[model samples]
Target: MSNPKPRIALIGECMIELQQRADGSLLQSFGGDTLNTAVYLSRALGDSGAVDYVTALGDDSFSDAMCERWAEENIGLQRVQRLPGRLPGLYCIQTDAAGERRFLYWRNEAAVRECFTTPAAGPILAALPDYDVLYFSGVTLAVLGEQGRGKLLETLVEARRRGAQVVFDNNFRPRLWASIEAARVAYRSVLPYVELALLTVEDEQALFGHADSEAVFAAYAQLGTPEVVLKRGAEACLIRCDGQSYEVPAVRVEHVVDTTAAGDSFSAAYLASRLLGGSPVEAAEAGHRLASRVIQVPGALIPKD
Candidate 1:
């Protein structure tokens, strides 16, 4: 008999994105870290596993377009809750003359902020333990508030105990958290339950003030996670698995049109390859292949064709 396909659920928000151009105009699209990862994971896995996006959105035109886009990508949207009279968040990206990007947000009242507090959230939380894999990120944790984080931590523990793998991405954004201490506490609470961790070395250093890669590796090793992948933009990635370490070089891109979802896409492809029974080295290669292509495009998702 063939083995059953794994079910993976990614929990996070996707907002309306405005990419500012040099001509003073904005190109509109939709993206978020976990959402980007979800789309890429679904694409990489194809029919090998089921991929779902777990979040709340408003019943607005933008929400409709977002759902349509996700559907076109063959991602499962059953876990996405639509809230009445609430709208999705919006943000604009501004790039300097040198092409470095900065983000301006207007999302304080977005619908996803209430995603885990509503009556419908009870079922969603309960359903989480049943999935083969549950993936979330630091941004997801920061946006969920203290009460929601506690509930989520409890759910993760239960899900792990019941044989589900919990994957975490450390997408640390300092502006999102009130203080460094709070982010540290929240991250520490989730570390013990994480089976696989996708970390960006720069973000990790900013959050924990790690002196170097060895310090970062030592910290994650103490957490007792079986696998850890450290991403360094434009450089090689570091992988630590089963007490063995490997340095995987990133695929070089001739031109980088945009770096919006580079790390997120890499994490998605890496995890998808692993779920399909590929080795860590093979998964890392797959990740680099995808991310190398992603950075060459102008947005979070590149055209599959």
Candidate 2:
């Protein structure tokens, strides 16, 4: 008989999103780095695997709506914590004529900040290692703060020790960090435990000061990360998996409406394909195809009719 469906848990924050239209109207929604990945991954995997989101939220209406949306997408929220009297974070997206996007955040007091540090988070942390895969991003690290991060690192160590593969996305946002060195130290502390690393070329350069792609791969090689993918917008993505390298070009799109969630969507498809036993090259192609379509849409999540 075939193996049982893989159980994966994604840890991060989900925010109330505002997408600014050309007419300056704001389209309200919910999105976040790992949450976007969770939605897309659930859509991609269907009944092939189980996807759970691990985070903290408020008991407010917005949080209620977010959970409703996740349920519609078939993402498991068993690990979600509803902290009394707290609130979810918020962000706004502004797009340029070139379809590139910028963000303004109002997430300092979000309940996810207490995700791993709070007493209520203990049970969730203890249960994380039971999953087949544990996924998170740099944004997850930034929001977790020092104490929460310490708790998270301990959980990751225990999770990996129990045979759970750890997946990481270096979705670096400089503004979220107190300083460059602090970010570096946090990342270094977790890098050795990662089994797979999904990285963007620009974010890698900005965060690690790597001059080029070769340097980025060389650094990850030192960390003994077995699988590494470098995502470059509009350019071919590079993959170094199982001691081999491959370059897969992105699908060309003539008219890009909005570039929101491009990387997050790509990461989701890539991880999904890999979990489904696709080769690295095939996974890269799958990621590019999904990301190309996402950039042509207006929001982080496309309608799932």
Candidate 3:
């Protein structure tokens, strides 16, 4: 008989998002890097695999709406923990004339900061090894403080030993980290256990100070990861897998609206395609195709239609 479909758990936080217009009005929504990946990955995988979101949130109306929305997307919510008297983080995005965006955050006391430190985290961490795949991004590491990161690293090591594939996306946002050295240490700690890495070239450069794609690729190669995919916006994504390298071109978009989740969406499709048995080249193509469409929309998520 064929093997059972794999189960994937993406760990991170989902926050309340506000987009500030030139007129000084704010449009409200929900967005987080790993959450964006979870939603897109679930949509890309459909019923082929089980996709679950693992996070902590407050028992508020906004949190309720977020959970309701995830349910409608067919994402599993069994690992979500509700904390009383706490609420999700909030941030406002302001875009320039060139569509470049800046974010102002109000998330220091967010409930998710305590996610991996809560009593409920013990069972969740213990059960993580049972999944076929575990995915997270740099933002996940940033939110989970040093102690929490140590715990998460231990869980990742155990999960890998149990044959779970650990997929990581390097979605680096410098302001989220206390210091560049701290971020470097955290990333380096997790690199050895990662099976597949989906990296954005720009973010890699910003985080690690790599001069170019070759430098980025060289750095990951030193980590001994077998599969690495590097995404370069509006250009080809470079892939190195199974002793072969491939360049997959991105689909050109005429008009770009919001590039908020372009990398997140790409990571989702790439991982989804691989989980479905697609080769690295095919997976890269799928990622680019999805991201091309995502950049045309105004928010992190686009309408299913």
Candidate 4:
């Protein structure tokens, strides 16, 4: 008999997004790292697996619109929290002539910061361990603060104990933490529980100062993570799976439009491929295929076909 559809939950913040055009006009929308993954994962998986976005949002219109968009993608919304009187975070993306983008954030008072602190969070925390796969990123850890990070770590422990596969992405943003030491402490604490790690070579170098991809792979090896993928922009991605390593070249894209959500999109396709029984090489190819198409678009989410 075929296996039942795996229940996958992606935990992170979804912010109100603004895209700054070259003529200085701002287009409003919504996107986040994990939210990008959730959307693309839903698109790639279709009805093959269950995908959910777990985060808190305000009762405001922006939050309402974010919900509508996710639901339109067929992503699960049962665990989403609507906090009273709070607001979703906002960010603006500016792209250079080369299509490389930078962000300016005004997210200090976002509702997701209180995601794990509210009284309503108790049941949400309790329900997390029942998932078949739990995915989160370094941004998820950074935004959670110390207490929330501790709580999330504890939940990861319990979830793994219940046989959930823990997937982590090291999408490290230096501006999010008080100190590199603090980020290191938090990342180290969660590393052992991770079964699959999706790492960006540059982010790993920025955070832990891994001199090269070898050092990054060696570190994850020490942590005993069974699967690891190192993504390098416009270069080959390195993968270690099932006690062997594979180097897969990225799909070439001419005239890159926006590099936003490139890694997020890759993670979505990679995880979807793996969950659907594709081999590691096949999964990396799937990741490259999706991400190549994403960067040629304008926003974190491209228009559905």
Candidate 5:
């Protein structure tokens, strides 16, 4: 992006997080892959850029607290839609000794499933093309469903035509899709409009059956994506940009408390550094530093300090 501090809107769901402690107690919090990135992106940009979250919620106290927290984090609330009878989704996080996490979801009927289908979405959709950047994830595609996704795809088409950069992260979850074929269709449909793709090697392998980073890069290249970052956990991230490839090493960490938001934090710092006019290598380094710190913490969101 040309602007040092660009206007960015992240589209996805934020759920009530129930993190299971070692003592067998549940710790309440708010977290989602895209929401984690939004909070970190807002912090990384400070007052220089704009970060907005686009989603739907209900009239429940949980939803109220979510908006309150997002406001506190400096994420814009203008695009939030409120549905009277529905409620936000919930999820539980379980981490093993290695800090690798597993998720249990209760969100088949989340309010965010209707985020782009509401009456309020018309204005939000209209305003989207004006932003400097539009960001979303594979999970965002999964939850938004058919109708909501249609609106989002249409907005992305317009946004691209108006010169807005569209960013996508491949944070895939198999359980969220009806089949692997369905996920492939969804991903392929939106990829043509994407300018930068923040992809995890595992996700790309699982989603498209790519055997290695070369295959992943070749596939995205064939799809005509300008830039792609292939993140391999604990290994160096490979960046393919401007027809050049660079390998930026990940930070070494002896301990990982929870791997919940490692990739989210990485993407946040990467985007922030890019907006601040850093090169691909510099941005990837920033991502590694932030992700190294995030993995040392226990949750999706670490302390701002």
Candidate 6:
């Protein structure tokens, strides 16, 4: 019989998103890095695997709506925590003529910042190791702060010891970090426990000061990470697995709508393919295909059909 479907838990924040229209109107939606990945992963997996989102939200209407949306997408919500009075963070997305997007965030005081600090967090953190895979990102590290990050580190140690695969996406947003050095230190602390690292070369260069993709791969090699995938925009994505390397070119899109969640969509499809036994090259190709479709749409998500 085939192996049982893997259970994956993605940890991070989901924010209220406002997309700017050409006519200067705002379209409201919900999105975040790990949340976007969770949604896409669930869609890609269908009934083959399970995807759970682990985060703290508020008891506000927006948080309620976010959970409702996730349920509609078939993402598991047992790990979500709701705190009274606090609300989800908000952000606005603006896209240029080239389909490139910029964001303005009001997430500094989001409820998820205290995700690992509250009394309810102990049980949640303890349960993370039971999942087949645990996923988080640089934004998760930044938003969690020092104290929360310490708790996350402890949980990661336990989770790795329990044989759960830890996956990280180095989605580096310099503005979220206190300083370059602090970010470096936090990233280094988490690297030793990661099983698979999904990285963006540009983010690597900005965060760890790596010269290029080779430098980034070399750095990960030294960390003894077993599998690594490096995504380069509109170029071939490189993968290092089982001591072999493969390069997969991205699918070209004729018309780009919005570039929001492009990397998240790629990461989601890549991880979904990997979990479902796709080869590294196949997984990379899958990532590119999904990302190309996502960029042709307006928001972080597209129609299910």
Judged by whole-model lDDT over C-alpha atoms, candidate 5 comes out at 0.94
Residues 1-305 of candidate 3 have per-residue lDDT tens digits of 01257799999989999988789998898999999999998998898888899999999999999999999999999999999999999988887765567889998888888888999999999999899999988999999889889889999999999989899998888999989999999999999999899888888888889999889889888888889888888889899886699999899888887788888999999888888888888888999999999888777888897
Worst 10 residues of 1 by lDDT: 93-102
lDDT of each candidate versus the true structure: 0.90, 0.93, 0.89, 0.92, 0.94, 0.92
Put down candidate 5 lDDT per residue, 65-171, tens digits, no spaces: 99999999999999999899899999999999999998999999899998988888899999999999999999999999988888989999999999999999999
lDDT, candidate 5, at 151: 91
- 1-305 per-residue lDDT for model 4 (tens digits): 01268889999999998999989999998899999999999998898989988899999989999999999999999989999899999999999988999999999899989888889989999999999999999999998889889889999999989999999999998899999999999999999999999999889999998999999999989889999999887898999986899999999998999999999999999999999888888999999999999999998999987
Task: Pick the winner on TM-score between candidates 1 and 5.
Answer: 5
Residue 255 local lDDT, model 3: 81
TM per candidate: 0.97, 0.98, 0.96, 0.98, 0.99, 0.98
lDDT of 1: 0.90
lDDT of 1 by residue, 1-305 (tens): 01268999999889999988879888999999999999999998899999999999999999999999999999999999999999999888776543456888877788888888899999999999999999999989988888878878999999998999999999998888999999999999999999899998788899999988888889988889899999987899999989999999999877777888989999999999899888898999999999989887777778887
Q: Give the TM-score of candidate 1.
A: 0.97
Worst 10-residue lDDT window for candidate 2 reads: 1-10
* Candidate 3: count of backbone clashes, pairs at least 3 residues apart or interchain: 0
Residue 43 lDDT in candidate 3:
95
Q: Give the lDDT ranking, best first.
A: 5, 2, 4, 6, 1, 3
Ranked by lDDT, the better of candidates 2 and 3 is 2
